[model samples]
Target: MKKLAITCALLSGMVVSQVWADAASDLKSRLDKVSSFHASFTQKVTDGSGNAVQDGQGDLWVKRPNLFNWHMTQPDESVLVSDGKTLWFYNPFVEQATATWLKDATSNTPFMLIARNQSSDWQQYNIKQNGDDFVLTPKSGQRQPQAVHDQRRSGRHYPSVQRRRAG
Candidate 1:
């Protein structure tokens, strides 16, 4: 009986892995077809206790192979620009702009995933569909510090910028 139970568990694990692989492939194919995208967004962030910490609005622009810009207009003004090779972060209130090599910026970030076209990078996250949304969890075995709910719009596999509430 114990042997049978172990075999059943292994089979179930394989099934789940296959399902995730299919979802990831579909998402990759859809993302590859998008050459440019623009969207306006409103974001609300809460603390661990679920208290509202910040609310803001922004606009996002992405021109693939790898150009991205995010302009935040409310709460505080800030801009993030990536030109395929480098990432620049600027805050008007602070009068400072910091620049870093895109390769060094880490692939774990959502914006990086959108800006990067490599399939290997996308594979770093385990993606699962949840009702009308998708949940992405890192494959590194570390628990995600926060939850990100991705709601697909206009029948696209990837969530629109408006639905990406967490950065």
Candidate 2:
């Protein structure tokens, strides 16, 4: 019975691993086909209790190999730009702009994973597919794990519905 349990566990692990590998491969293949894209999005962030915390709408332009400009126009104003090397964040409401290396920004932003084409960058997350949608969840031991993982269809790894928990 013990051997049976051990074998079952190992087989289950292999099946899950295979699924993750296939999803990752599919994602990388999809990313490679796109060089750039532009999209408009409305965002709502909620707390752990599912209460609305903040609402926003924005336009985003993403270029492959690490370049993007995210402009938020609602509920205040801000812009985050990455020049393939440096990450710049600007807030017109506060008149503040901060700069950091692109490497530093990718650790926390899921959008960074989409902007990146390398499969190596994706290894940090587990990818699961649901029909046309693929959900990417950051694996345990991340710098700061997010509680909600968007169920966005692989339409560039960003989902139409977003929910975030306030820390």
Tens digits of per-residue lDDT, candidate 1, 100-148, equal: 9878875565455566668777767787765444456668744342333
User: What is the C-alpha lDDT profile of model 2 across 1-167, one tens digit per residue?
Assistant: 99999999999999999998997777666656668777788877777576778989999888887898989999888999999999999999889999999887677445655687565667677877766556566775444323323334564444332545645
Q: What would the TM-scores of all predictions be?
A: 0.79, 0.78
How much is 165 displaced in model 2, in angstroms? 2.9
Q: Which stretches of candidate 1 lie over 4 Å from their true place?
A: 46-52, 141-158, 161-167
lDDT of 1 at 121: 72
User: Backbone clashes per model, in order?
Assistant: 0, 0
Top candidate (lDDT): 2
Best by TM-score: 1
Any residue pairs clashing in model 1, and if so which? none
